[model samples]
Target chain A: MTGFDFPPPVMPPGVEALRAEVRAFLAQSQAEEGWRPDSDFGSDWSASFSRALGARGWIGMTWPAAYGGHERSALERYVVIEELLAAGAPVYAHWVADRQSGPLLLRFGSEAQRRAILPRIAAGGCYFAIGMSEPDSGSDLASVRTRAVRSGDGWRIDGTKVWTSNAHRSHYMIALCRTGPAGESRHEGLSQFLIDLEGDGVEVNPIVNLAGKHDFNECVFDGVTIPADRLIGREGDGWRQVTGELALERSGPERILSTFHLLAALVEAAGPAPEPRLAEAIGRLVAEFYALRAMSLAVAGRLEAGALPDVEAAIVKDMGTRFEAEVAETLRRAVPLEPVAGDRDGAGGNAPSLASALGASVLGLPSFTLRGGTNEILRSIIARGLGVR
Target chain B: MSDETLRLIEQTADDLFAAESGAARAALAKGEWPEGAWQAFAATGLAQAALPEDAGGAGLAAGLAVLRAAGRHAAPLPVAETMMATLLCHAAGMEAPPGPLALSTTAAGEDGDGSTVRRVPWARFASAVAVVGPEGTLTLRTPADVVEGANLAGEPRDDMALSGPPAAAGTLPPDTDGTLLMALARAAQLRGAMEQALAMTVRYASEREQFGRPLARFQAIQHHLAEIAGEAAASGAAVDAAAEARTPFAFAAAKARASQAAGTIARLAHQVHGAIGYTAEHDLHHWTKRLWAWRDECGNEAHWWRVLGTDAGQGGGAALWPMLVAAGTAGTDAAAAAGEGARP
Candidate 1:
């Protein structure tokens, strides 16, 4: 009578074998490519590796077979992505497409859109960027001022999208723009347009991050025309479509396991002969990690059963991002090493590769809470879901 | 395991809990045994809820449901303790005693190497005490000395000193560790209490208004409610996982996570409800106080965190994930089912 009815998580049968299979593939790939495990998987891009995973039917795994998908269960998809994130796979190339765009297209795009783009996504040959966040509207997504007015048999879009990850490299952008006037409710009158990054009058400017990465971008659309078929769902439906899309974007093992490589590296660095203090910190992190995993996995389980666990997903992100940030905090107190600037070659400074991993995580901490909806915005969303607002 | 069966258990427990909790609270506040309350609870067969079906017990899942229901109402029924006591009695082939039960699970500190566990729940009121001492697992029928103490919720958590050894009568199974069982029981109670707090907070936010609107309409207030929701949601999920699985790892993690949520949930619920939630007449403190007490009772967050953390930490990062995934796992298929389905 009084509780959030989160069904206890139970993955599909034999996910461990799938787990082992993934672990083996990651190890083999890491060995063959001589790449170090990265702390942030979603931020790091690799076209070859994304293609490799796609070839294995690991990307877009849950879609129907007609769309070049493996038609596996959501649980199976959960297992693969969790493994990919845990091992710090360079999944950025296909991360956005595989995570939300493909699903959105399948659910709301026209048959023509699905046929044209879904297979490319399934093949990991395409990349996409979320255009929900603008320079003016971060968490206040409904306040997006980007306009897409009517044109001859198409629409002309003019807006600037900020903090758009992978926008420069992405093939398309699912931009939420205003097609109509903002009425009494701010949520109404918005529409989602599929904008091509290569279209005329489109400019992508690099927004360098604290971590010295060029993944984040600011894209300006100047009267770029997109055909009517590019509209996702219907007119005046972008708010609902994007809200659901945000849920898909925010939830996932990625949010929780983004900094997992650092935690894993901490365990390895501490070794079996850890001091009491070190041991306690390790133990604490592990316990919390398991609990967070249980909660996150429950969300996935609910998703698989055809329920949208938006609040549950928000909880995961809120708790999960804090935990992700805590890894660095825990490392600082538990271990004794000043975080020197990490070189790309894993050398120069005497800091362990673990230190470099920690360094990378620390530099990206600000974005962890900011990117997938700010923490404050997430709390408001959670509150609304609780029927409080 | 059918929906009807679980529904029956939930409805019956909720009804009994609602009916008896006020009277039970009066007796508990006076530090007296609520005989009528215990009888009403026992009448539901929750005392034997965790016993195997063939043993005339309702099984673990049903027992947890009963505990959760009692916890939601703050019924002071000792549902978890009674079920555990009955299971132990049934296992050891002893006649189980009637009335209020208690369990002492904490290990004796290094200060005095005595065979005892301090702060045993309901020790003064218990007919018998199920204990895991330095000697071995045993239940003392008559406690020699009980230094009276109460947790933050006013429930008796007396320090029962065991003067003599076990009766040498029925010995508990070797596999039983009182501390772990206590963790499981306390976590279940915390889960129930948090649910009550969440429900109360939501209702209060929806009804109480300021500035010509319900408190729920305020963005800041909604944020606080959301915080509590997140805590309660995570705590509930973890506790359910522990209850359904009943593994050492699962139980430990559940206790740690639930305990961790307690501090924030109690604080924010009070914050959202404003000053009114602090009063004794409001009934909000009842659940929050219980959450405070139960979180630190069997094993606090720190205790269980270390329990899970050390084992997992020693395994290093590579082994940690597998260990977690393997927590409630049995052999191949059951593990996979737990992987793919619910508790095996």
Candidate 2:
């Protein structure tokens, strides 16, 4: 019988030192800056904080040194990112570029594009937003109506991408567009281009989320022109390039630790010696977390060894996202506190931080399973992996 | 052991059990010990695989791999219990008794009424039972009588009434937690059981038809099978990680995860199989029933959850992170030692 293989990860050497470095940096940043720790990665964006991580050589860690990377292993990068995520650090500015765009460029971008954009990304001076989702397309990405036609020495893109997080703040967008006939398969004739978000005929309109945040944007491209070299990989190979990185996209600390601050807060509220029942609740979540981490690490280890392990990665995301959502619901019952709108001060005469963290998590819960492909989509991917569909 | 050797050992054990599947089940139905199967397995020396080289055994990795295969086949004998007994005896500086064995932890009260040690797997068939106390004291006993009991899988779980003093007793090695070891054993078995259940369900779903297409072609059915696959994978990874780590916390997490997966995997497996899987005639029950029984064996999800939660909550919230980070490397030395201990 066929089965998923998650061999034990061979951890990179000297990770303890690297873990120490990340922890110390987070502690110093929290103490000195006193930034309100975001409960999740996408909730907050701080350019300076991104720059701080970049200056420490933590971004683009696994890429070549020629592109401002540290030439570190993926496991090392995993250590840094997990540490940052667990602390709820403001990693949004460089998150997309560091996580997906930079790696994509390293894999499929031209040398000129790499030399130009990768260094900026590693330095945390530049950021990117995904332009795959459009007004007519979310999970059915192949149905995107965005069109990029060949113009003299360049390409002209015209389309609107919805749910484009941070499109306003990002420097560039990797837009997937139909460059040729649909042919027999809809996935055919699609291409990805590096469109400058600030170029002419581009518009960014804010779409407020349930949390009263402007993280989501609707980006409109009215014939925006990009250089011919901006095409990522080969034209019409967009589907493979995008689908190839699901393992990298889905199986990360971000997927699991999105609501970790809530769990941490619950632990804090439980105090030094919680009741057995409350401890059990906490322990239940921790046990799930422990197992999920091992699975995630196994996938990461496989990725570092150049194996996709996409099925295993999908399992991690499906379970990890559900676990993330479960944390909030469990904490609501486990911790007897009505979530308050975060006041950002102690004037409320209550455990404001716990209540506020709980509040943020509850509000952010919907996106846990929605963003980065909904749980249904992930389950389908897992089923395909099982060869049952 | 190298990956190649481990694969070879597991393959050998799998072949042996596959060949014995019919006889093992026949013995269970007849209410008699499968003496032939027992002798055939014992001749392999794989039972002592976890003992040190000086003790003439393979290693912990080999031993756990063998347990996994035993779980896959739901081997009727007390293979895991015997392995634990052998390891306990070797740890206590004593040679294990020959024949099928079970490890028991309970002792008769001072009242001396000969009240039985309840639910010890294959206890009636065991030539000797190694009882290890919480403080690492090992007492090897030959039971005076046995009352037959069975788990949901119809595997022997007899009650042994101790009458006289132990035949042999000694102190186990320091810091050895018997319950944790048993939990690890059960978790490994659960991993194997869940995997087998998933494989069976996937095959059934692929072959069975409804609405003019295979059941696997249905989205709803596919999702159910997918969830089962996730649980199985998580359980397997958890057991492997716990074995490699060998810490009490790691073992607790493994057992909790496995026990947690058993319910969902069993339910989904049966659901995908429809009426056929629920019947006693089908082989799927061999795995599902064992999953239901094995989950509550060492400790259920609630029991281990408390242990993990309490350990996680020490020294307030800030201390939890360090403890978790430390847990990643908690028992690496023990695991590495167990691996190298059996090497020449």
Candidate 3:
């Protein structure tokens, strides 16, 4: 039998209370700000919104309270993230820091780094972007030519990271730069350095995305010197450390709930007593959402049980990302949505609310598969685990 | 039930298939009944496993596991139908009919106006057909004068015209959902069939050689297999969730998800298997064809999709997520419960 097991995760039933709390918090927060939910949760960055969430003790929920966290159960965190993603909240600003970086710092960072960063992340005042992808190295993280050479008691990082999300607006970045020799293993001798975005040698150039948004950037690191303490984990432990972070990044509700706004819109547009075809389409999307959420929650449970569900995480990412994209395609079929370039000012036009949601979803569809880890890469991970090669 | 008992059930089902299904599949494809296999399946108590403890049967989950095994083997004995019959008969506090059984919800004319259910599965072989409808549950002996029909899988789906005096077995409770129960049954079978298809495809991809290497070495085949893995895994989770919860929405979602996956899986498994999969000689068609038949049997994607979708649609935009949560479990929602009762 294949070694992968997604045994229906057994979570205590108390998470419903947490889910209720999250829903209530979101309802009150969204109403108070008069903020309508959006489809593209990945690129929607609202620092104030994140701080409000942090004040509610939602950010870094599962981490320890000593680091400005609530020290709650993993399911509670799952509820928080699940609600945020479903509501299509502006979670992008503190998303990276809260989801992976803070966790990574708690596990692998120096004491001082953890003290300086974890509380700020829990406060939603600190934001971080992943610096794994480079101009030439996308999925092939080991081939990153960006070198962090040792200098006078510090490292001079010099590499250009492309497709760096939120780097222009974020406070810091965790760049996976080569620190030492490649040796025999291609993954050897690399290191992750915490780069301050406002550092002297750093330049952030914007890359307009399909939605014509300024969420992505090309980050150039030219002799950006940082103290040795800025390096996350040991010098040669970058590959393993980053893999763990990616695992944290991959299996979450955000991957599957990106187009939830469109789903709600589709149901609303169908009105009461829709054609059988329309109702079925809406039902199918909701069904897929339910199934994927179940799977995602199971994976989360596995992670909470202190097992690294790398293969399971890959399955969730591969399936969850595709499910999000399929939501857009099915929405197109349901409401005839078209992809239109917008300057992020809500695509102002006479387009119906359904059409606007469809367009937003259509624009974000390609990123669904491309971001986090490409479907191709995640599949390779699954293939490797399946012993396909 | 303890894990040991469930493992025993799985082991017994596994041994039964290992001893019989491998040889009987060819005969089954030819529309010949596998009597030996059927006897072995019944002897193991899988056919009557769904009956309650007072009725001398295993639990629902245990029986579902066996049903999945039956599907895994593509066992052509109507084991799933027999299990359903055993449960219905037990629920009615009546003795199960002899031999195999079929199920139908089609209403029969009381005055013998020749109203008949077409494609009643295994009608020609079964001793009785349980006709469950909103009116009541009627156990009708399989009429001798029946026109035999087979689905894409060549399983016996004979048309039995309503005739003679049928036994008034029992009445369904106001909340008993024949459709949802059948949907869960078919979903379990689909999950089992898809798992086998995936296992077969993965094994084939690993062994079959192309371009001086195993087919698994090729990225194209790997991606296809990966997709199959995702669908199979997701379907498995859905089934387990529904089985664990046993709620109306859970079963509905499971059926919809499994049926949705089965549609793509049949094609992808064949695509991975290439031209050889098209032939009847290969064992792949038995499962794939069964998937095709099973996907539409209890409730296809459209049937159950619209059921849950109309509920969400009727609830309007603000009620969407809450409706989803309520639909996923037997949550405290009077409106959603009302919707569940009204589902066909």
In the order shown, the candidates' DockQ scores are 0.58, 0.70, 0.58
Per-residue error for B148 in candidate 1, Å, reads 2.9
User: Clashing residue pairs, candidate 2?
Assistant: none
Q: Whose DockQ is greatest here?
A: 2
Q: Please provide, for model 2 over A1-389, each residue's C-alpha lDDT reduced to its tens digit, 9 standing for 90 to 100.
A: 55685667878789888999999999999877766665488867899999999999999999899999999988898889988988878899999999889998899889999999999999988999988899889999889899999999999988899999999889998888999877787788998888887765579999999888888999888888878888999999988888775556787878888888777777777876879898889889988988888888888888788877778888998999899988888889987877765565453431336777778788888998988898888889999988866
I-RMSD for candidate 1 = 2.0
Displacement of residue B320 (Cα, Å) in model 3 is 1.5
List ranges where model 2 is wrong by over 4 Å: A344-352, B52-55, B106-115, B330-344
* Residue B272 local lDDT, model 3: 88
Q: Give the TM-scores of the predictions, in the order they appear.
A: 0.93, 0.96, 0.92
Q: Model 2: chain B TM-score vs. truth? A: 0.93
Q: What do the candidate models score in CA lDDT, each in turn? A: 0.77, 0.81, 0.78
lDDT of 2 by residue, B1-344 (tens): 57898888889888888788678778877998898888889989888876655576666667778888888888887888888788877766777899988887532221123355777777778898877654777788886587888888888777777667889988866645566677777788888888899999999999998999999999899899889999988888887777666666787898899999999999999999999998988999999999999988877898888888888877666666666656655344354223232122
User: Where is model 3 more than 4 Å wrong at Cα?
Assistant: A3-5, A199-201, A336-352, B2-5, B27-32, B52-58, B106-114, B136-143, B330-344
DockQ of 1: 0.58
Pairs in clash, predicted candidate 3: none
Clashing pairs in 1: A11-B339, A11-B340, A12-B340, A283-B309
lDDT rank order: 2, 3, 1
